[model samples]
Target: MQYSVLGTTGVKVSKICLGTATFGVAPTAQDADRIVGAAIDLGINFVDTADVYGNMPVFDRPGAPAAADREPAEQILGRTLRGRRDRMVIATKSNGIVGLDINDRGLSRRHVIRQVETSLRRLETDYIDLYYAHDPDPDTPMEQTLAAYDDLIRQGKIRYVGLSNHPAWQVTHALWIADDRRQQAPVAAQVKYNLIDRSAERELGPACDRFGLSIIPYAPLHGGLLADLRVLDREVSGDQRFQGSGFSESEIATAREVERLSRAWGLAPYQTSLAWLLSRPAVASAIVGAETVDELHANATAADVELEPAQLASLTALADQPPAFQHRAGDGPERPPATTSSDPTA
Candidate 1:
């Protein structure tokens, strides 16, 4: 497997990270064991999960299953990594509904502190390699959250901080806050980026590039739309993203074109998809999920597939379209330059 440094950190992680979002739901506990074992055998040392994963029923939905009946993804992962926990760069997140209490969620100091302890116990680990604020918490001031993360870093509870599902402005704000406070800042970002979704490139990509933050893209397959070309001809059921609504017509058409290109290049659809994502700027790794051991092996091999420059260009042109505003004949007015001071928050 290939490896890359996570942002500016000295530590290296596999280009393909094993995602455990489907751990307790699609794949049984036994299946998880085999899949994780195979991932390690294939040289994948990075794993990503969230406290809210594990296919649990909605905490607030009426008629939902009792809290005791839930099976958190962390618990399943903890059991699977009994003796090999130290061999992986494990990442988990907070700011998700883990209980029915009003204070059970958000990036508040109380929630972050309480959840870190809960995650440690569930994962059977003393410290988390990377901890993320899963989503933005507008109610809680950014300083309060960063202060909590800084304290955790000083305590050695987490090695690094990351942000997920946050807007470009918020990401920069957090970085500025950390810099101003002389606290540890986030070194990476986890977002939904793939062949079908290039939205991250709009502003998030440039922000990460300028701030030295690595982009660890999840859902690289677009909910399996790019995994296999055959899904086009068959019915898609039980899919987490496209189960009920189904894929849009344009999305299917794009997948079909990708399939044709993959055939011409003599490569699997997933390999082509993953290679293209890895080639993007500021991307440190792509998180891929699998239901079985064989599936994991197949996805893991993408780390070695390298596309030709011409091939990469063609695939990129398929999805990376410029904004409509840029199509105008005349150039738009120039914008003001960003802050040049050492403290961007100033």
Candidate 2:
């Protein structure tokens, strides 16, 4: 498998990150073991999970058919990575906002501190390679967030930090806070980027490029849209992704066009889509979720399939239309202010 540097953190990550969102859910721990084994066999050294990954709370109730309230995925991950934790770069996320109370949800110092210990205990690891704030905390100030991350880094709880589903401006501000506070800054950003969803192309890509932050794109297959050929016919198979995505008819046509290009290029649609994502220098890793061992094998093998320039161009032309807000985020640029009382530079 091919590897890439995870932003400024200097960690060499596999181009395809193994996503465990499907782990320990629907499928048992044994099924997860098989998938993990396949990923490792393919030389995938990066694994991504979250504190609330498998806790599928249906109908807005906390009591879902999950393994447990906390430490479910981590326990399985630790058990699976018995002799290979050092060789792999492990990452997990927090701030899922499941509870009804306010303190249970944001990137506050208390929440971060509370969760870090819990995660460490669950994973049975001393330090996490990467810890991400799963979502933006609108109520918490940037300085407070940075301060919490700073403490974690100082205490050696988390080695590196990242943000997911956050806007470019928020990342910019977070970095500014890290700079001013003389703390560890987030070296990566995660967003939904794939053949079906190129929304990150406009703002996130450019912002990460400017800030020296790497992009770890999740939903790399548009939630099985490009992977499953049935999506070409504008039909979804009872997946939550379809319920929330609100994909338009035009988007469906574009996906079919992408499928057509895949045929012309003599590659699978998922392979072409992943290869296209790998073509971008800003993307460090593409997180792929696979439910079964066979699916994991198929998705992991896409890294070996390289597309020619002509093929890349054809695929781009087929599905490169920018959305309504592409130029807005790119055009409005700002330098975040320093966040300390005593400025270092005179």
Best by TM-score: 1
Q: How would you encode candidate 2's per-residue C-alpha lDDT over 1-346 as one tens digit per residue?
A: 9998998977899999988764565345666767777788899999998776655443122222433443366677877887777877999988776466868767789898888887888777889999998877656676787788888888999999998877777777777667876888899998878766678877778999988899999888777767756754543322453224445676667667777888887777788888888887599889987767777778877888888898878777766564532322322342344435523332
Off by over 4 Å in 2: 58-71, 98-100, 231-247, 324-346
Model 2, position 95, has a per-residue lDDT of 79
| Tens digits of lDDT, candidate 1, 268-314 | 88889999999998999999877678778888888999999999988
**Per-candidate TM-score against the hidden true structure:** 0.89, 0.86
State the weakest 10-residue window (summed lDDT) of model 2. 58-67
The local distance difference test score of model 2 is 0.75
lDDT of 1: 0.82
lDDT of 1 at 305: 95
Q: Taking the candidates one at a time, how many backbone clashes does each contain? A: 0, 0
Best by lDDT: 1
